[model samples]
Target: MKQETFGRFEVGSCSRSTELQEERELIQNPNLNPGSSSLSSVVNECKKRRPINFCQEEEEERSLKKRRIVQDTTIPEWLVNVMMREEINGYDPKLILAKKLYKSDIDKVQSRLSLPSNQVVTSDFLSEEESRVIYEQSVLKNRTEGLSVVLVDPLLKKHVVDLRKWKMGGNWNYVFVDGWNQVVSTNTFKVGNVYHVWSFRSGGGKLCFALVPPRNSSDSGHGGSSSGLSSR
Candidate 1:
């Protein structure tokens, strides 16, 4: 009876040991029971690590998208076109285009247009000294022709006379006025027929034209007129 009881106890102990070994083997090989509690714990840890890595990737993607949006929003297509056109035209078109685009002001547009045109004129008879002589001649002729004369010397930086106090050049003819109010007195000095006059202050400068009437013409009261000086 004692031997049978000991044998039974030993057998039971062996069975329990076998069951524990089987469970340890199953835990060691993840592929054996991938859904086991121990496997489930590993999967949970992997899942946790995946989300952290995914969140970092998502943040990087969002930052890239934000930078792209900012770059696209800052530059407009029209402004780019204006910049390219300016390169071709040799002037800053952006500022000019802006003034026109925003305001329908004709004066502003005309002021910008007054910049030199592309026309070229050549005169072989007018050397630098001869040119001065011709300018003086033109001024005297202008005075006789009832036009006003004003001489402008860029080098002197002084007006021969105060421009404002002088009367507007005669109504019938174009005027020749210098930076100083000095009217050309002789027929020997003449500037070009088209002259550009700029004032130090706001109201006085303009472009003037000297008109020589054709013979046998009846338009005595109506002489040549200057266009750019008049306000828009």
Candidate 2:
């Protein structure tokens, strides 16, 4: 009985040692199949992802927006078709932002559409001189003015509007003030409706935007796939 017990203990010890040795070999051997062992596969995957995760975390920390802005390239064909007009015929439209209307957007009192800086996807729509003006105004303690731009609705009606960088409390936001009420009333836009805003240059190099509504009433806003536009 004693001999049999000792024999079992010795076998168990040898099995454990063999496993440890195999683990070391697997780590050292670069030629081994990645899927051969589950443990090694997990380790390899983690090693590959470590740098990517670290970079993303670092970028998020540095940006006040907390999220990276990626340009939306896959615009819908129907939207492109509608934007084909004499004024902006040759210019290719780039998506600037997509958002669902908030209560303040449709409110008569607010009389503006607020575009949060954090939620903005592509901000390169502004020219160097335009960006400089916004930066200069942002630093001022009082009496900041807005830049006038032409905003075209779905029906190709132009609304001359003032785009301003308004700081509310602690957060900074971009707003289409002044003539925004006209846009809301003319289009009959309501809260919770999703719209896509595209930027382009006119023949005379004037900065312009085209606002595209969701493809259908049932379409989900906020740039969802259901709205016929991919989410960033």
Candidate 3:
């Protein structure tokens, strides 16, 4: 009888089907001796013992570090000053968005601040709990209400708002509602005015935003020249 060897796997005058069955058994049965099993089967068993890939985890950490670097560089000096204020003193504030206000933003009927998906600076700024709440309420249950977030205006006044995703013209937009009217009214925000939105965690780890007005706006009471996100 002729024997063919494949890295310790020997087939001696056996049918192809038999060979295949034996190979499958050797791979599936963990108790099988490595001396009798094919090299490939032994390797597969070793892989099963340690499923985690440390290389992949290291790569993900590197990616997150890069994102943090980008966020730090993008935040402007004026915004940093706002974050450092006694009333604010935010935790690692990152500029997450900037948009020119539209009529719909301040419209009493809408009563929401629409942040288009494309205009956002970073989508991963939400904490795990915040993301889970938004996903369960907005995506799973299809509820109009979502995660509650604290929004700090340029004046450093905090307003609690509901954050949810809304589909419009086949694209999804993140919107602040159910308290946005207060922010608009309190800030005296006007249409066509540009505003920068910054995100940071509160001391208690709550999601918060700083809605910065145009640098020249008297509404903010921060005496600086008119500045938009043109340079950014």
Candidate 4:
């Protein structure tokens, strides 16, 4: 029904209807409401502004932690010279060196280890490249080839052993044990294990060395794990 006193659009104008709908929408949407503040809007804004990923940050932190592991396995050059000089100058170096077993240290040399009468030499006998460094020392280098030198035990002066430079193969730079099998048998060395060698006597025709067994796996932190190895 039309009001006789009003114009054609006076009943319900489009502008009036649109203004009412706008008020309803503002009331229904909390984010658009001018009368209240929304925490969700603040959170969305923060999320949009920040492009950072917490998971990536965590991973990088973990990687940095892992990289902190001390990597000082190989002995320094100066220390090698000190050990050699201690032997040559009659000071008799007194230090314990640890070495992890490699395939070359045990597997490839199983035959040499088992031979009761045959002598074998290895740079592996000394700690931290000591065997190689000793060979380069003037005392042993200047001596005639195949000259046997007694290595007296540091802990036990009476415990005397003999060693020499054996030039069979592999660049002719190796510490040859005149009685290697005997030493291995005496120490009960097993493959896939780390061993310790100590030096004491070098001058006076004696060079002393001692063998020590690994306390546990953790102590073999020097690396070159000897696991999954066979004597064959």
Best by TM-score: 3
For each predicted model, how many residue pairs clash, with residues at least 3 apart or on different chains? 22, 0, 0, 7
RMSD of each: 29.1, 13.9, 14.8, 20.8
Q: Rank the candidates by lDDT, best first.
A: 3, 2, 4, 1
- TM-scores for all candidates: the values are 0.20, 0.58, 0.59, 0.32
lDDT of 4 by residue, 6-51 (tens): 3222322234444555556567774674434453444344344333
- Residue 20 CA displacement from its true place in model 4, Å: 37
How would you encode candidate 1's per-residue C-alpha lDDT over 39-108 as one tens digit per residue? 5665554443331234578899999989965643343322222223321221211110111111111122
Best by lDDT: 3
After TM-score superposition, the amount by which residue 113's alpha carbon in candidate 1 deviates from its true location, in angstroms, is 36
Give candidate 4 misplaced runs (Cα > 4 Å).
1-93, 102-174, 202-205, 216-232
TM-score of 1: 0.20
Write model 2 residue lDDT over 70-179, tens digit each, in one string.
32446755456544545455365678788788898889799988888887777788989877666666656344576778787654457888787888767788888889
List the global CA lDDT of all models: 0.28, 0.64, 0.70, 0.39
- lDDT, model 3: 0.70
Candidate that beats the other on TM-score, 1 or 3, i.e. the better one: 3
Report how far off residue 217 is in candidate 3 (Å).
4.1
